[model samples]
Target chain A: MASSKAQAGQTLWAKMPKANAELFALTYGSLVTELVRDYEDPIEVNAQLERIGHSIGVRCVDELLSKADSSNLGSAVTQCGNLRDTAEVVSKVGFRMFLGIQAEVGGYSQDQRSFSIYLQENPLSTFVELPTIGDEQSSSSPSGGLDDLRKLKYSNLYCGVIRGALEMVNLKVECTIVRDTLKGDELNEIRVELKEVLSDGAGDDYKEE
Target chain B: MTVHAIHIFDRKGKTLFTKRYTTTKQQLMQDAEQVSEQRKLIFGMLFSLRELVGSLTPEGGSPALQSVKTGAGTLHCYETISGLRIALYTNNNPVMNTLPGARAAGGESTSITSFQTALKYIYSEIWVECVVRSPLYRPEDIQVDPLEGRDNNAGRFDIKSTNFEVKLDAYLSSMPWFR
Candidate 1:
């Protein structure tokens, strides 16, 4: 009985059922499709996508905390501790808890306020092709320069989620997809930069201003 | 301890999914309207208590509310930092419900924490798999219709995620304390 109970605590992701990846791909595909159809400008599409992502991030963070309330989580959520610990939890815990992805947290800033989460295995790209030369969508830059990507951040919403969730935890941070395989980068990396930590009883003041 | 039901809510006080595992004699589990009424009251009461606890904190004194108990077992509530609320009201046997306390405190809460953790696991994993990940259901906030009438479908709202139900049932039955 004890062994089984122990197993329950450890059976984190491997034991849990996997979400239908096709469904995830198709879902994202449909969302992008809707955004494209609605907005003429790709910049607008990116903003809307980020907004959608922010809402999900804010909620998904709650879901993440709800599912696993560990001692580390208590500190991490209440008053976020050191930079490394916070990034480790975000890269490791957040991904595995939600998508069963094991990401490596590294590449810290000189001041220790920024870091990159290397997403080696991302489910979002299983069906998504990398943006490359000769991709002939109107949204794509006519010159096909790097400027094309300036308009569309394909997975900006995921980054938005991280930012939104961090803000909800009283940690004001900026999360952006610095590198993406979808954008011809060798790997996908999420760069998180700490802006400020909203301290005790000062949350409303930030909102009021 | 017996968790009679699990109610999941969004940050905006919307009911995402509610699953009742055990039947209670006090509130007829089979009655649709009565159960809905009870569920709503439970949501309201829990929400109010949570807000009160957060508000009543002396300026700069920030402790939070965990659980509330009465003759009707205990209401173990776990609120996420982002304001999502999940409440589990159990009607365990007298011994399992032994020495009920006014609030979720000390040792009783350790077990509750572990259980809540497991429940959280289910929420993030199974529920996300079956509910949120579904493109058809929503990528937006779930509409929490306070006035949406109750249906006969298990005496409440139906998210129709059979996979979630199956996984949750399997997990609960595997637990030694589930009885």
Candidate 2:
């Protein structure tokens, strides 16, 4: 309870009961929808959402770093160096701390272009229902809508955190949410690809400066 | 240590901005200049103080090390061209350890106090200070000073010792500038 209290004060999901995960997800979705509708500027909304995500990422990074005992041993140096290691830490630490889910780190590609983290179950995202307002009702049935929601891959929130934290380290990465991975599957897998454009250019300006 | 520069892009993958700051004032200034220019390419900047704090991570040494989630120092930065949003958040509050008092206050009874505490720390102390002081923002544009209200079910507790959620609806609703 003390740990929960301490963590609650710091994390985005603080005070969120286990029963309320679905509600929180729905609220999160609705908030995004509302922001998009009100702003009507994809750039602004996306940027704002990314900014929010970035902040969360920064906080999450702190949490991840603190939890790095010998049991979770993977070189911090390597984790700090490559995006793959960082992604592993993100999925592992993110699930353990926030979602109460244990995520498995999957294979890393040879070129290091892509890596995967698989969540056996996402309790936080389960049972989320996007409140259908006027006009959106008849277009899709609840089951179909739920399926669509289930297909929602990646927490832009976590993506923002990863992207932002990497930026703090001066690593330019292009993060994409792979929705296909979230489809009917036993495990919820997210594939994070490090953008080639920036990776190729890494350390170029820093060395010169 | 290798200093890596991260290029920030919009959702469309357009290179809207990039910045790299070292411990040196010269490098910080240069990075600030680059960020300023990029801000012009993007819209105005609207960021919380925490983002500014997070941006200071690359400067190196104990300052950067201490600044992580446990540091007491303030982080501040802004891109005027990016719509000039600034954030100032600290990971250095000892009050978080005293959740028993907060918890004893109870959810229903202490809801207002909890919300007030969160606002006091996050918005007023961290956010507003950064905004008012930033060169990017006009004082009059802020409109509401220290937006405050209560959060009913907003609270998070974990091993990390952080759980304070102040509803941003009033602040969001009041921000005529925020589209």
Candidate 3:
């Protein structure tokens, strides 16, 4: 069967399955807000959040790839693609499947070792407010310069998600937050660097991005 | 709209986690053994029903059976591409039950998809955070040791149930149907 996404060319983005950004925002907000209440150190909470995202990524990949198999889309791009094609499928198809958004793919390395997925819009930011350094806050020096340097990395969870998802798909990739709206950047870009391919090519027999 | 309980089962019909909330019925399960037995039975029934429905439909059916109502309550199920199965069992609201002619004729399919979706998010958001990321819990440890009498006990992963319980309570309480 042709993918529902492919059939609706002109209105594909509009036709794609969408969820209320509020739902994700609130859920993520709750987790983040709770971490703030529990840990005195925001940096520690940042690491924990990424770790949590990694766990989520591994399982989310399971949900994504398996569902794709049922639709036959999983096999069409299954494996045997060069690094560029794999990255393209991941940034384009995978993003659409999960978040109902398309990512801009660019900044690929000549050695085929890295690429970046630019998220023009972030659904996870609906409820995210960059934490401000209170005037009386003692975590940083009196100078706001030091405070600015101490970024909370609210979207690091997403970086971990990329790493976790890629690892599960048999591509050992290091996912890093190249840019994030949380830190005043206009775009949320995640740079994915291939570390090593696992012994089993696709993780599963025919797992796609 | 209230989620009574959420159960995650592996491919072999073993229970991974079955967290009950205020909405779950008491008489259906009296003790731990009874709870496990009832879960096993529910798993078996759902498995059979899925196969039955799949066989009855043609190629490309309208997304597997959505929800089914039994005499007790309603069962909303979501199956992952992998073998993990998450089922949300909820009791019919007393108010809905009292509506005349509604019970006999069968009511409309509840918008339980939202609840199912939330549960899937919970699987990724909470369960993975608690079970998969924690140093205390090992994925390999989720196994059965008959001699130790921990059969089908989710491989002794030692889940921090209290944390999940608190969050689930908060999550259900936040839903509009909780009252």
Per-candidate TM equals 0.54, 0.39, 0.50
Residue pairs with backbone overlap in model 3: B142-B155, B143-B155
Lowest lDDT sum, 10 consecutive residues, model 1 chain B, at: B94-103
Best by TM-score: 1
Q: Which candidate number has the best DockQ?
A: 1
Residues B1-179, model 1: lDDT tens digits: 46677887655455666777766576554566566556666767877786688688886665566678888677777766655567776653423333345234445555656566665666666665676555444433343333354343333334663366687777765554566
A143-173: candidate 2 lDDT, tens digit per residue = 3332233323335555676676555444556
Task: Give one digit per residue, the lDDT tens place, for model 2 in B67-132.
Answer: 123243222322211122222222223232334343554346342233233323333333323432
Candidate 1 ranges beyond 4 A from true positions: A1-40, A48-52, A55-159, A163-209, B21-26, B29-34, B52-64, B92-114, B133-158
The DockQ scores of all candidates, in the order shown, are 0.16, 0.03, 0.05
lDDT (C-alpha, whole model) for all candidates: 0.64, 0.41, 0.63
Could you arrange the candidates by lDDT from highest to lowest?
1, 3, 2
- Answer with 2 or 3, whichever has the higher DockQ: 3
Fnat scores for every prediction:
0.30, 0.00, 0.05
DockQ, cand. 2 = 0.03
